[model samples]
Target: MKLFLIGYRGTGKTMIAKILATAWNCEWADSDGEIERRSGKSIAQIFSQDGEASFRKLEIEVVRDLATGPHKVVSLGGGAVMGTENRTTIAAQGLTCWLQATPATIAQRLEQDSATKSQRPDLTPLGGLEEIQTVLDQRFSVYQSCADFEFDTEGKSPNQVADEILVTVAKEQKMNS
Candidate 1:
């Protein structure tokens, strides 16, 4: 099954997906990257030029296409789980691991990431920590509902988080077997 990483931006989903894919010797795809590749535009550009509805349309298509393919790791965009159709599709397609972090931590990480400002768009008029907290509060329950597994990314490196995911997934597999 596909291993889908779902979480807020800057929660290390993309990094952990890379680590997990490397450990599993499988391919990995970043939904945001795929969206950008298909549209020939950055996420920020998509949001600003085409609008969020347009971006969501692309996101849904990308998620569905990725779900039907080989067993790979996918790092989904933060708000990808907000749509009912997206949540249902994800649930039916693969295992979802929620990579979580406090709003402060996410804000800090986003600030540190050089590409974030250029690639991603601000979801609210309140930018920085305030925006992060507001969005996280809105998405908390949705993320919880969609997650098959959850990991707090605070005080941990990407590899460390990936290690925890590997252990949990192995136990889950063993139990299922």
Candidate 2:
């Protein structure tokens, strides 16, 4: 079964996806990294040059390309779900795990990640708990709507979260079988 992990930024989707992929012995890919690799540009650069609309178009194409392959664990970029076609394709093609996290948890994680260093476009201007909450609020409904399973990783390690996902996937496989 294909496992697609989706959630807001800093929700541990990529790390947890890696752990889950290892457990499942499946390949893993980060949607953002795939986009960057395909376009020869970072996400920030894509946003600056082609704009979010164009970036989403490329993202949807990536999703289409990836969706055709075998069962694998995929980590999606935060805004990937905003595209109507991506959401529909994911809903039709895979089991989506929503790593539901409170904005505070998400904010702290983002701040602590060395690479991000608080460079998220939305948070750059009003960098604080409130801004993060606002952004999550805007995106929450769509993520929740698309998820087949939800895991709240408020204070858990990636290993623990992966275990939960593994167990859930095992049970789901059994049920489907």
Best by TM-score: 1
- Candidate 2 lDDT over 48-95, as tens digits, reads 778888888999999877776887888999989988999998888889
lDDT of each: 0.94, 0.85
Q: RMSD, each candidate, Å?
A: 0.6, 1.6
**Angstrom error at residue 126, model 1:** 0.5
Per-residue alpha-carbon lDDT of model 1 for 1-177, expressed as tens digits? 789999999999998999999999999999999999999999999999999999999999999998887889999999999988889998998899999999889989999999989998999999999999999999999999999999999999999999999999989989999
For model 2, the superposed segments whose C-alpha errors exceed 4 Å read 117-120, 123-125
Task: Quote the lDDT for 177 in model 2.
Answer: 95
Looking at model 1, which ten-residue stretch has the lowest summed lDDT?
A: 63-72
Residue pairs with backbone atoms closer than 3 Å in model 1 (clashes): none
Clash count of each predicted structure: 0, 0
